[model samples]
Target: MLAAHGFVEAVEQLASGLGVSVLVLSLLLIPVATELPEKVNSLLWARRGKDTLAVGNLSGALVFQGSLLPALGLWLTPWRPSRDVVYAVILTLIATTWLRLANRSGGVRPVWLLVNAACYAAYFYLLTLR
Candidate 1:
């Protein structure tokens, strides 16, 4: 979370300095770049055979992206979410619930990966409509 704040601060500073269409470009890079540290941390854990930590990091990211990030949007911006955004939020809630159940039962089958792909497609479709 602090890393995300630092990432946002760095991007804002760069955008402010550039003073052009810098925000558009910087925002595009921010997500992937901000993930660098987490990726490295996960990779190191995996290399040491600490698989659970690596997996937990990935799962925590999913939860953060789905929940906390959207909450931040509401707090930081005056713009209201569209109906599609509301639907996305509801769908995310359902997905997270399913994830919790899977985690509890150790029932996250390989076939469940297909469901993830479907959800990803649906997310983009909703975004296009928005």
Candidate 2:
């Protein structure tokens, strides 16, 4: 995911130079950019018999994005996120809540996957409208 994020950052930089709007760049770049490392890491971790690390990387992105990244960004500047960002943040929170609720009841169910897919759809839709 970290490596994927770097690619997104590169796209954002190039897009900015082309006078592309942030919203459009974000919408276009995020899906492709975020998935590459996630998929690779998951596959490699599974191959190495380190399923825990693979899962951790998946969940850790949420925590890192929700808490660490923005907090640090806030410290650097008086940051005020745009409305699309707010939507994205809300989507993440909702997804995390669903995951947490699932975990509390024992093992995960099929609904968790459905809910996650819905969340992704929502985010993608929101991005497209931007």
Candidate 3:
């Protein structure tokens, strides 16, 4: 609806805060919102004592973010991303790859969360540098 209403840019600008507030807010919010439904599903599964189901949902989410969505975005967007946008995407790729690799080791380690935190920090730092 925000996109169809011609307010995508406006909402994104407001969310990204027009250079006054850090654009990291937009980046951080994106994954959280995207993962929220999966998290909700996992939480429901956990409540039913289905820890494995929760883990499966998390894995599915990681795959969706890592592969499907980004591929679709690239296929759909008409123009190439700017250098800064590309750099940001590179950061995302790095973070997501690291996450997938970490998940392969059989548990969510503290370091993975820390890496994500560092990614968020890097996003804010880049916004500041911008």
Give all TM-scores, in the order shown.
0.52, 0.58, 0.64
Instruction: Tell me which of candidates 1 and 2 scores higher on TM-score.
Output: 2
Model 2 poorest 10 in a row by lDDT: 27-36
| Alpha carbon lDDT of each predicted model | 0.71, 0.78, 0.75
Better of 1 and 2 by lDDT: 2
93-127 in candidate 3: lDDT tens per residue? Answer: 88888889898989778856888778767766776
- The C-alpha stretches of model 1 lying farther than 4 A from their native spots are 1-33, 49-72, 127-130
Candidate 3 residue 91 Cα shift, in angstroms, is 2.5
Worst 10 residues of 1 by lDDT: 19-28
Off by over 4 Å in 3: 1-10, 16-25, 96-112
Ranking by lDDT: 2, 3, 1
Write the residue-wise lDDT of candidate 2 on 1-130 in tens digits.
Answer: 9976777688878878978666657654674565568868888998999999988887887577657976898899977888777877898789889899899989788867799789878976876684
Pairs clashing in candidate 2?
Answer: none
Model 3 whole-model lDDT (C-alpha atoms): 0.75
lDDT of 1 by residue, 81-123 (tens): 6665565567667776777777677678877666656765776
Point out the higher-scoring one by lDDT: 2 or 3: 2
